[model samples]
Target: MTEPRWLDTEEMAAWNAFVEASNLVARRVEQQLREQAGLSHPQYEILVRLAAEPDGEMRMTELAQRVVTSKSGLTYQVTQLEKAGLVRRRNCDTDDRGVIAGLTDAGREKLREAAPGHVELVRANLIDVLSRDQLRVIAAGLGAVTRALRERP
Candidate 1:
């Protein structure tokens, strides 16, 4: 049997730091969203993506892909948002089997209200902590990783 390679000390330190930072950042963002907007981080992400669309609308499948959630998970979130009057589901015009989720005016307002605090939290936790060059390098490295993952079968 081939022996598994383990991370060296320096690599282990980097990996641990990455995991810790990621967890902390996610928790902070989630807390801020829940406290200030009564929204979970995932829901906030959905709102942000829909708001960016030309008509504040997107297919459920597309949204699932963008948010990196399963179709069932997106459906649940969308259903919750719908009950809160933040979003509505519509039949896709060209495909009877497709579902589209569109942000309501209330949803847009909620997003507008939540945006400032969210941006501030992100800056406080992440952006402001890094130099411009460091940010650029991190972005490039993460972007490469994201692309690779998405391209995998």
Candidate 2:
């Protein structure tokens, strides 16, 4: 096997900082969502995605893809949301084997209640920490990485 090239000091520092910041931000957001909204980060994301859809619904598999979650994970989250009367699962009209998840009115209400705290947490922990140019650079860098990963076989 070929010897692996290790990260240099600058690269190592950058990677470590990125990982640390990402973890801290996620934890803070999760805490705020759980405490104020009784929702997990993933649950909050699911609600947001559904809210953005034209019909406020999406196929389960599509939702999983958009959320970067496993099919089973999405199913479990949907089940939990259904239990809370925040979401419902329906049979897909055109596909017998497919299921769609639709956001309920209760879900929209919860999202509306949760959004302010969530946005504040995000701004305080992340967006407000960076300058506009830094934010742009960070977004471009992360987007490039995302595209590269998605393009990989």
Candidate 3:
């Protein structure tokens, strides 16, 4: 087997910082969303994704891809949203086998309710702590990581 290349001191520190910061930010977002709008992060993300679309709808598989979730996982979240009257799923007109998820008016309202606190918390915990250049670099780096992962078989 090939020998593995380990991270150097600085590289290790950067990796640790990235992991810790991500966890902390996620925890804060989870708490804020749960308290403010009764949402988990994934569910909140689902809503946000749907809201961004022109018709506020997307195929379940596409949503799963966009949300970085499995189809079953997205199905569960969408089910919960449906129970909460926050989302609706329907047969896709273009694809007989595809299901589309759409945000309801209540989902829009919930998102509006949750967004301000979420933005403020994120700003307090992450965004406001970073310079614009830092944010850009981080975004580009993470975007690259995501693209790499997605492109992998």
**Model 2 agreement with the true structure over 5-54: per-residue lDDT tens digits:** 99999999999999999999999999989999999999999999999999
* lDDT top scorer: 1
Native-vs-model 2 lDDT?
0.96
Model 3: per-residue Cα lDDT over 1-153, one tens digit each: 998999999999999999999999999899989988899999999999999999999999999999998999999999999999999999999889999999999999999999999999999999999999999999999999999999999
Which run of 10 residues does model 1 get worst, by summed lDDT? 10-19
lDDT of 2 at 129: 94
lDDT of 1 by residue, 1-153 (tens): 998899999989979988999999999999999999999999999999999999999999999999999999999999999999999999999999999999999999999999999999999999999999999998998899899999998
The lDDT per prediction is 0.97, 0.96, 0.96
What ranges in model 1 sit over 4 Å off? none
Instruction: Kindly give the stretch of ten consecutive residues in candidate 2 with the minimal lDDT sum.
Output: 144-153
Work out the TM-score per prediction: 0.96, 0.98, 0.97
